[model samples]
Target chain A: MLKYFEQLGHKLIEWITIAREFIRLFFETVFWLIVGPFKDKPVNFKSLFFQMVFMGVNSIIIVFFVTFFTGVVLAMQAAPQLDKMGAVIYVSSLVSISICRELGPVLTALVIAGRIGAAITAEIGSMKVNEQIEALETMAISPVRYLVAPKFLALVIMLPCLTIIGDASGIFGGYVVGTTSLKINAGLYLQTTWKFLSRKDIYTGLSKSVVFAMIIALVGAYQGLKTKGGAVGVGRATTISVVTSFILIIIADCILTGIYFFSDM
Target chain B: MPEKEIAISIQNLTKILGGRKVLDNVSFDIYRGEIFVIMGGSGHGKSTLLRNMTGALIPDSGKILFNGQDLLKLSVAERERVQRRFGMSFQSSALLDFLNVEENVSLPLVEHTKLSPKVIDIISKMKLSLVGLQGFEKYYPSELSGGMRKRAGLARAIAMDPEVVFYDEPTAGLDPVVCAVVDQLILDLTRKLKLTSIVVTHNMESVFRIADRIAMVFKGKVEQIGTREEIRNSKNPIVQQFIKGELEGPIQIT
Candidate 1:
């Protein structure tokens, strides 16, 4: 029993250490960004813009197409249940609320985490292993300011943009299902979507997106920066970065959503 | 014997990594305008010592005095001011893979100075020429040969006209001709630029060719340090075994 308690205590300490380090990294990245323009920034913004494009514009088609398909699935599932209650007309409201409030930001964040998070971790981890980070330091450069800050800023901007696109595509998907398949009045569908979905839903989704963006970039960069060993270590960091970002995005979504849910109640 | 001015004075430096004493009570002084080589067997803390000297790794205890001022006690901005006097070339070259050669060389110049692009370009070209890599300006690091990559790394290191340049295993993974070329470059840079060179390597031939003085690290301590001729004539059997590469002696081949 003593051994069991000791092991549990050790595990708890381990997690706390990880969390503490992550929070420190988060603030350092934020501090660099807040003072970025005033500092002697040798940041490669051209590369950052390209990465932002990769994170935002490149993911557009796939994100929209995937969310469009999901909207169709949501409508299909909802039509039967609402129809049995003689309320098939509410499907447009149901789909719009679900996509804007829940699916849009959450799904976009998950996909971006899987795609770009792995890349950030691998790139930074490779640099860390190669002594490039130390080289930068010896050059009087802050790796956080030079590397992580640009990534954080770019992703924070891009994820919200991608989330908005996901929102539009999903709503359009619902439109198609409700009008052509369900034979609901097109005008009525539009009215219901607009009526049920307020600016708050859209704003909150984008806010969630911004929060998710910070999580993914910071988590990925943190894992990458802490990487030791060589090739195998870099590969492991990439995997952990993706997994951690995914889990954190979900947890953040739930906590934010719960706060809003309760306040609205 | 004429006394030389100390460029860097290291005092009883000790560093522990993962509970292992990689650097233990090591002390030495590298004179100005001299190529000081730290040589040892693998896993023997030679590179660790170099890292400590370059301020990349802070020792658990001890002082690194650059021209008599303690490097470890300075504020962040002040330390960076002190650090700007250093340039470190890694074993792998560690060039930013995304950047072209000229861009990589121009990095420090652009970061630390307000010089115009035309001037930065000219200086970068000059440094590259010094390293014998003049025409390869547009090529990325990947397009260069292993030796060319090392040259470019050296070019970048000296970009800021730093007082001290640290080279970690400069001739590793290169042909003998290329090794000789790198050695010649180190000698030329030390003479022409008057920059202090602290090199860490196990390549004994390179050491003898380039070192003005040598420090042999054994078991995390500076077991022996002397001029090349003195080290050659020393009666230390372990040092002799290392320089001779004999499997018959004290060092256990792991």
Candidate 2:
């Protein structure tokens, strides 16, 4: 019985060690990515533009559709409950605050994880398997500077932008549901939502997005860079990256929520 | 010139894998402008030795001197700088599938040099032309045949005008005519560029066609080093067996 317990303890320790190494690599990659563009060499604007289009601009449609449905669902659920209490006017306010503070950022991150994270992993992993990364190294070009830094900057700058769009679209979605489905006054719904929503709530959503962007970019790039074997290896890395980024974003959202609520209290 | 002026010198190099010595205390020197071929049977540590020379693998114990500087002692940055002086072609012809032929050829120049895009493009086109791939620049790797991909890889290798170029099985997995074209390209490039070339191949025909000197690796050691005529006419039974393509000999096929 003691041997079995000891074996379990050993396995747990091994898992912890692996997790710690992964975290260390994550932060180290972030540190280099932040400092890379500011170094002696001039920044490659062309690469940066490509990354922005790839990571940010391309993700807009998905973000719009997701946030829109979320808002519609929120209004549909809240109207009947609030109508029973003679507080149907508060439904818009509830949708606004919930979407802006939590739902928008979290859902956008999940979508981007599947989209951007998978793309980065497949791209980098294929490069590894093909020796394109080694080819870059052999040319005296830093792969981190050329490949990773641009993607990191693009994600950091774009995730917040995406969240803002998501927040606005979600409010618009709520307005649609309130006016059409709930037979609420459109002007009254918009005015109550604007009055109830504060800058703090919007800022919280954008802040969570920044952290999610870091996690997605770092995890995706790490898995891609470390890919081994060949096609099968790249496929495995991409799957792991998407799944891991999704889980990390949720955990980060929960922790940030706890801090935001408790600290205010 | 004295032997000490060798371009590359390896001493007591060893690499262990799975509790067995893949390379055991192997040592050799390559001259400044000679074609050095490391010929061996498959899995005879030939490619491993080439990778070690290029600083892609760290040996368990050894010293590698390039231009009399200890390559193993350099920092990663310093080693990368040294590595830039050479070019490498892989056995798999590892071309970037996303890039067209011209873009793939122009990669090293775009990464390392301050040349304008126009000049880079022109030079890339010239490289493709040099490799007999003039009309194929706009095509992707998938669009090209296997032989064309190998030639495209060669174009990329010489894109930087490297001092030393390493070829890992340049003629493997190709028909005889394609193999001859690749071999001829190796010879032409060596002569025209005056580059120090090291090729790891088991193809005897390729060795005869391009090698200025051949170093046959056997059981993790250099079994012989000689000119084409000397290797062909030598009385060494192992060399004789290998040249004759015999399945039975001192070489154990496991």
Computed on C-alphas against the true complex, the DockQ of each candidate is 0.83, 0.51
Give the per-residue lDDT digits (tens) of candidate 2, residues A1-265. Answer: 9999999999999879867866776665566566654654444678778889988898999999999999999999999999999999998999999999999999999999999999989999999998888766656676666677778778989999999899988988999999997888999999999999999898988999999998898888888988989999999999999999999999999999989877879
Candidate 1 local lDDT, B1-254, one digit each (tens): 57889999999999999999998998999999999999998889999888887888889999999989999999989988988899889999999888899999998888889999999999999999999888999999999999999999999999999999999999999999999999999999989999999999999999999999999999899989999999999899989999999989888887
Q: Which residue pairs clash within candidate 1?
A: none
Candidate 1 chain A worst ten-residue window by lDDT: A35-44
Q: Write the per-residue lDDT of candidate 1 for residues A1-265, one digit (tens) a residue.
A: 9999999999999999999999999998888777666776644678679778877888898889888988899999999999999999899989999999999999989989988898889999999998889888888888898889888888999999999999999989988999998999999999999998988898999999999999999999999999999999999999999999999999999999998776779
Worst 10 residues of 2 chain B by lDDT: B1-10
Q: Taking the tens digit of each residue's C-alpha lDDT, what string does model 2 give over B17-120?
A: 77888898998888888889999888889988998888777899999999998999999878877887898887778887867999889988887788999999
Candidate 2 lDDT at B98 equals 69
Q: Which parts of model 2 are misplaced by more than 4 Å?
A: A1-43, B1-5, B17-20, B233-240
